[model samples]
Target: MPAPVRTAAQWAQFGRDHVSHGLGRMQDLVVVKGEGLDIYTSDGQKLLDFTAGIGVTNLGHCHPAVTAAVQNQVGSLVHMQCSIMFHAPYLQLIERLLPVMPHPSLDQFFFWNSGSEAIEAALKLARKATGRPNVVVFQGAYHGRTYGSGALTRSKPIYTQSTGPLMPGVYTTAYPYWHSLGVPPSTSEEEIVRLAKHQLDMLFRQQVATKDVAAIFIEPVQGEGGYVPCPAPFMNHLRELCDKHGVLLVIDEVQTGFFRTGSYFSVNHIKGFRPDIMIYAKGIANGFPLSGIVSNKEIMATLDVGSLGGTYAGNAVACAAGVAVQDVFASEDIGGNVNARAEQLYNALYALRDSPKTAPLVAQVRGQGLMAAIEFRMPNDPLTHEGLDKGTHIPSNIGKRVQEFCLSKGLVVLTTSCFDTIRFIPALVVSEEQMDKAMKIFTEAVQNVANEG
Candidate 1:
């Protein structure tokens, strides 16, 4: 098919008419250009990007290093089947990535194209390594949408509605969300962690047998379920449980990896937790499609040759970009910046959460590093549903309203966690000035929503 030459409006209409609506469509703006965390629409409006293309561009859009790397590699070698031959960029990336692994034993890697594919690959590795038939996942986790991934995702019903019978032997367990567990806002972190840890034991006895499980998948900070950070004590307990059961502790850092969580990985916040397998994507290449998993040699050895690679698994261009990303991180204090900005963001969000007008609507303000969220709830509403019955918070699209309002103010944001929570996942390269500007707009959006309500 040839490119269509049409006006911006015409192109937009054509997309609405011809494009498959299955993909998530949050806004209608047609972006034409991007630079350093700002995107330009066809109308020549500049929007400060807070979503960072849904956490893909961690170094900001079109960082000079990444652009140069891609341009340089495209002219040399863009595609090389990993199964057929090896490449410098791929090996170089592995070399750079090895030093950053949380544990020294996590030395093995298998590249893939997307987070979903990496997750699918990890699932296969777990099952093969343990020779177990069952996999365990937490409730309200969003691993991916592929059929195999869908079986593990329990964030929302729409993801798996009419998509089952999902893959067999996949079990769901409750995660620690004190606000959603009917606990008062004053509940201490220790108590929440205790209750959450206790649920795992109940799940094992009442639900799936721990002996049959191959892996227990979880996110240090829940992404789509809301940017809820898992408490350290709870994660510590999970580590103990996995150790006792010999289940692989697979941490899905697809959204939280690459310094998004202040640390190199969110799991790093916990003192002694070590994952058996770590899967990463999103910011791995600062926008390029690259994802992979790291495991020790022994577990990785379980897969026979020709068992785990794809034709385009380690594409040269993506690996080159990945290599450049690591270089950028080495030179830039991105992890430091994320921590500093996260503190500022949390202060501002807490102000909003505590203010008179917004307090009643905000159920909680939670985050770690740059990954943050403001969860909204309408306590006065008389409506009762499954979420209410199950003691889970049901969003009322307040986050979506805030998102649209932010867009109107030349800022871009995303809604997550049941459409009730506003997630802030800006690029790690975002400056303090940019953060203040975005927060100003966000504050007004919350105020406007409160007034309208």
Candidate 2:
């Protein structure tokens, strides 16, 4: 017999009783179905989804091409242990992705089930390849939640609060945040770049030696770290540092991959920046659970034949979806859409950022392509006024308030990166009409929160 569907009250009670408390949900949304850029709730309300499942649903929810590919593959085959046999979908996906990769030498691939798994694989590869003991990452970076990735993650304390003694040999350094360094608002981008390089030098001098570091992991567009795009100068400098020290540079493109940004990958935006090993996930399969890394044969060969093989790695259904996603990206001119819509969002958001009504609470509006954010300053934040530290600093609370207001107004948004920035990562298929509607709701929500303050 088929299982019976539960009513809203029953489902709520079941979730309360059965779901693990470790999982954090943004809003009280029990979605029944999704299509395109909208999700239908159990209460029968259609919400314009701007979160895109935290940057997973790049081609939009249940894209027809992806759905058809998955359905077709599920009938023929689903699980194929990669170590035991070769599968067509997996092979096809690799063929589809290779042409669009930023670098010509990033030809080899290794598949995994999630971003965290891919990260762990890359960590092993780095250590094995370089014969080094330590790895370096940045503050405010969010890699993943596994013990290995969590050690590299610095976005939030709650992620590793009681999880004792995370993987050792992981070092953290300051990323370039011009606003947080207490630098003058008038500081030019060149000055900010110099400050960032100085901080990095200080880290190498004080904390971990560059020679001992096996790899320096970077998210070219810091996703959970406030949608802050790494300046090209910094990326070039990092490349130079890695070359000088023989440390491999690993780029984590989990959240920024598959046309979420205007490019096929965020690394393309940073001129001449390339990684020794690059991790991929989230948008690769348009919500399907699949991730992998790309590297040259020389770097990938560090992992012995038996070292990387999961039972469900490169599952046929997910790989089929990935192939379809690539096809859609090619035929649809998705990059063009992202550039146009990103401009629309940035203009509307900057207007709100500069508005006399909302300017006080707005710290910065920054993004590239469709991955964007409007950071909120705490009530007593220094940027809000020349001199103030009064009252409890609650930018996170303010972000939550704006998120809740958007939810009530029939839009689904999210808070990310230090818990103060309202992140907007809509689907690649989001239409111009939808963009106008979302911005209208978002502007009003910000105004409402400002009024409350």
Candidate 3:
């Protein structure tokens, strides 16, 4: 067969015609392969990866150990229907992860292929256990885009624009980003808890009836909703509220699990916050497509043998990668390294805020662990206060400019739902040297694009 000769733009246009309009595609870089936290485009540009494939690659791209593990499993068995039977890798992974998890009561896990599927299972289990219908989510939440999880998502009209008439009995309340959501002032910690309680209380008035509500879904450190961490008191109180109302607390750790936040799960960050059910993925398999919903012995026992499984639910190859991921994380002090890198990155980006390059458009810097964001805002002339708090399309456009500049100059970053912010989900294994290289490039990109954006 002869090679198909066509320009990249032509190929992209072809995709545009064949694919649904809902799919977002851009002709930015033609990537070939990846290594660690760097990607090589078709044209031979090696770029530092801060997005980590949008937080999917916490161990880094094509990590040697993970790749080797996958290769070995592939030679043995890549696909096996756990619904029909079980495989070594699948059982092996659960045995390994059980001890590391926060809850001692957790006894069973149902493996799924993606974060959305994991969340879907969690929701189902919550309803099955409680025999309830209503589920509570928060404003600015971004769970996966499937029907149930998507229904739980409470951000912008765009995500839910075309897909409508979603699942009912899904309630929502604000999660505090005190400065952004027009909250008058940075509330005291007590006030934050008060506000959350008040909002949930108000929701019981109409959005969702307390008795019928099955679960309250939460992210310990929010992933897509601008990396906001729910304060400890707020989380603890929510636990109390769930206990009072017979609501299952479902922690969505799709983005916060697997040492991304210096713990196996971010829910551990709170003093006593533990979920009746939890979804885990992203970093668990170290870039493999393995996600799961875990629950207490009682809740998990409700499922019939055949109720929760799929053809590729616990893929041996993906599980093999997961097993190796945990091993490397444990033996190599990857968690410690993640903490050190977070500190290093926090210091670097914080210091760079005052740098001559980033002063104009930089509004706020916030996030946890390897998940961080640099929010770009329109230069509010504090002199006039024209739009001191009013959000404009300017920040969105500036973000695009910065993203392009980063790509052009050998760096990769991700934009967020806030539109004005670019998130950095660097790999847990990112070295100090790699960190310096990426930050230097970022500083340069900011300097180059600042005047224009």
Score every model by TM-score.
Answer: 0.95, 0.96, 0.92
Candidate 2 is scored at a TM of 0.96
lDDT (tens digit, per residue) of candidate 1 on 319-391: 9999999998888899999988988899889998779776656767888899999877754443222123445
Tens-place lDDT digits, model 2, residues 27-52: 55588999999999886889999999
lDDT of 3 at 94: 87
The lDDT-based order of candidates, best leading, equals 2, 1, 3
Instruction: Report residue 106 deviation for candidate 1 (angstroms).
Output: 0.5
Best-matching candidate per lDDT: 2
lDDT of 2: 0.87
Q: What residue pairs are clashing in model 1?
A: none
Question: Top TM-score: which candidate number?
Answer: 2
Q: lDDT for each of the candidates?
A: 0.86, 0.87, 0.78
Candidate 1 local lDDT, residue 203: 78
Which rank order by TM-score, best down to worst? 2, 1, 3
Per-residue lDDT tens digits for candidate 3, residues 1-453, read: 998986756665666778787777434456779888888776567778887777788888888888998999989888888877788998889888888878777768888899999988998889888999889898789887888889988766677768788888887887866543445322565776677778778888866678999999988877777777788878887888899989899999899888888887887776556789988988888778899988888888877667787778878899999999988877788788888888888777776666655554666677777877776664433321222445432333667787788777777787886546677888888999988888877777666776554
